[model samples]
Target: MSATTTYNGNDTFHGWAASAKGAPLVLQEMTLKQWTEDDVEIKISHCGMCGSDDHYLCESWGPSTYPCVVGHEIVGTVTRVGKNVKYVKVGDRAGVGAQSGACQRCENCLTGNPNTCSDLKGFILTYGSRWPCGTPSYGGYADKWRGDQHFVFKVPDNMTNEIAATFFCAGITTYAPLKRTDVKAHSVVGVMGIGGLGHYGVLWAKAMGAKVIGMSHSDKKRDVALELGCDDYIVTSDKEDRKRYFKKMTHILCTGTSPDFQWEPYFDLLKVNGHFINVSLPKWDFPPFHTYDILKNQVFIHGSAIGSPNEIREMLKFAAEKNVRPWIQKYSMKDVNKAMENFRAGKPRFRFVLEN
Candidate 1:
């Protein structure tokens, strides 16, 4: 295989950026670097707008680098691949998620936990971070992107590119915890929140043969949940009705970050020895409960980050096998600012994907 030469042109690509603190995202033109031997250049086809993207671009989480291009849930075609890249070939459809690179030789990497690699200092996030060579790591909001082969995954031939874009982040975020839990065939599983991550949780749990229940604040989504294969729908705001459904769930997955949420209601919903898993990044006080609740029921609470690459691959395979698909709205790449605004406003029907 011949090595690919460097690309050196003033290729104009449109991407949205937050050039300063507390400012709205603005569309900008950037010069893309030439492709290297270890690089795969993708002409981004679709990029999912995640909550994290909004958090980063608006500097909500913390101070962010200026000129940061922040979309991470990326699906695109490998327009060019470096000679050393064997995992992806030119023209192959691929996706990139929250992560872009890690130290592959660390203990964490060798053990399929590269996401937790300790020696890598700061993890190379897909956007607003410096690459190993010191160039900024841009994301998939633009017309194209160049990155190492390790961070990219080939989109299964059977999956639509729009859905594949979501699998890059939302799909894997929920799939990781579900795979690690005790919920299985005939188990009662409750998914709180009907947005991106919560929807995937309901779908995957149902596909895994669990009796899945969709829990939300409004009854309007009840029909949508059932249509998405949920066996039951619980409106959490109806106190008496919600109580009636409590104590039936063997497992509860909380995808919302309501710090003021009455935690006792959710705990009451769990059966003896039930487990509650949290995947949402919410600011909340710890639940105030007695030791009796823990001892009598053996209930447990836990949290999970996004999955490892191996886990992501398995989740994609599972999604393909189960015919799981996310409800998404597509926006043109040029309208990235509008997409970010909509995501911040929670305007997508479910998830938003930016298509080039």
Candidate 2:
């Protein structure tokens, strides 16, 4: 038999899958992509739930490929590793994030930004994606996960799987932008939203020695933000509150996906030539704004995705050293629906993780 058949014959994995758009995930059996020498198979122990999973499930981002298993922030035990896989061995604790594959030859990939690879074949998401060979890729909302070893990361022994799982997606997404903006002790950083991604932005910015200001629509997350180490909290809608911190921040990390996000007011909060990086993926298109906001102050606006493999490693080590941990609520893998319901109801203190 050929290699494809040989590999396909060895295993059929099981996971919770959505059969159609807006459908609830149901237990199902599925097959992984044809294994290659560069592949690794993991028996999942924990998986973090991200906002992106809900977007894909509800077709909020767009139409998703169905029969989709959608958890990406994965932490697990390495059950098997292909001959070519190194660093990750059987029984080792490892994790995979939002990215699964990328075209290594691309300039972005070679330069350590595989998450933003330019080629069509690159930018493979952990789920809601297909392998180049036309096989559908499943994610970590299951008993096992298989993917390119290059995208798999070894978890730090000092961290628990539940905590490590959140780092894969939420941690990297926030950490990448903070590092890129060169946030330091002198920098005053504004972290908007105070939810899943925003909480991390607040934690890491403070950990990086920057003074963090937690900005939200109201006082709901004020206590939590302060608990997460925010130097101060701002209610974005309050004009008096806005005036106190106007033009004070050196960098602002916008992590909220609200369709009604006030654009111009946030620009007003930035210092001249300051950077404002947005990491949220909202289903709605951002409202238009005036060009004067950019020309008048030379403000820089950017959009960042998840981090590279090297960045992931760096983030993990930093998180361990700093003792940074996410506030999370856990659910059994079998109760994914109930977990998702709580998520939709906005009940998570910050993030949620599923234990397999």
Candidate 3:
């Protein structure tokens, strides 16, 4: 590999960045990273804001690097590409998700699970971290973003920028888990929390030929759930209603976490050899479920991260063909700080996309 070249000694791009944790994100100028042989630079047209942005901005997850630009659901046209970037080229439509790079030769990566790559020493997140070259990694809350070829996904032409952007994070997050379970026509899949990930969960489940049941706490999402192709909708707000589905679902894809939620009922809804997959990071940890239920029912509780490069490709193709779209509220990049506040309060109907 050859040495990477700096964009220009003094070249900088404009974006919204947090100067300190919990501080209002302000418009600021940031330096462009040096170009590596395997990197792709994008002039971002759309960026999907995520709760992870709020988590880091509020320091909920942990301490974050200051002057951080945080929005990972990114989509744009490729403006430049490194010499060895085989897939993406200059002027191509592209997108990137939660990750930017990973050690491609590792055991986990070799098996096509780079999202959960075991190469901890070389794993790189899209933002709130440093690149392999020690550059402070800023995410898609910017005019432009540069990522490695490995993590950048080529957006399908049929998909719009905003929809393709969510596929980078929210879409793939749900899609990966379902695909891993190999959902098919006869599968009975329940999508819990019909919001950001849940919406995608329902669409992906239905598109994958599963009989999808959208389960939310209220009736607010009933129409949206049905619009997204859910075969049935269940309001889990009533405890008695949950019992109606006792041992009904073969798999439950949990996309939202509620502190006051009763777990036993959802557990009871699972079949003898059921699977409960959780992708949401709720503030409160769930209390223990019935020990006997787990032992006797053989339930599998699975945690999924984002998808690998191969999986991303498969999902993009699937989404484009099936027109898998996210219900999004579009906001301009200038309104990001205000948008962040609302995002914390759950203002967006499903997902929020920032147009640059």
Prediction 2 global C-alpha lDDT: 0.89
Better by TM-score, candidate 3 or 2: 2
Q: Candidate 1 or 3, higher lDDT?
A: 3
lDDT accuracy of residue 233 in candidate 2? 94
Per-residue lDDT tens digits for candidate 2, residues 236-355, read 878899898889999999888467776788888889989989998888888887987789989999999999899999999899898889988899999999999999988888999999
RMSD of 2: 1.6
By the TM-score metric, which is better: model 1 or model 2?
2
C-alpha lDDT (0 to 100) for residue 305 of candidate 3 = 92
Candidate 3, residues 1-356, lDDT tens digits: the string is 43443443334768798989788888889876667788788999999988777877888776889889999999999987877999988898899999987888888888888888777756888888787667888899998898788888788888888878988889999999899888888889999988778888988988888899999978787887787788888888776777678899999999886778667777888888888999988667778877887888899889999888888999988887887788899999999988888888766778899998
**What lDDT would each prediction earn against the true structure?**
0.80, 0.89, 0.85
The clash count of every prediction, one per candidate, is: 2, 0, 0
Ranking by lDDT: 2, 3, 1
lDDT of residue 93 for candidate 2: 96
Show the lowest summed lDDT stretch of 10 residues, model 1: 1-10
TM-score of each: 0.90, 0.96, 0.93
lDDT of 1 by residue, 169-204 (tens): 888988888888866896899999888888888888
**Stretches > 4 Å off in candidate 3:** 1-11
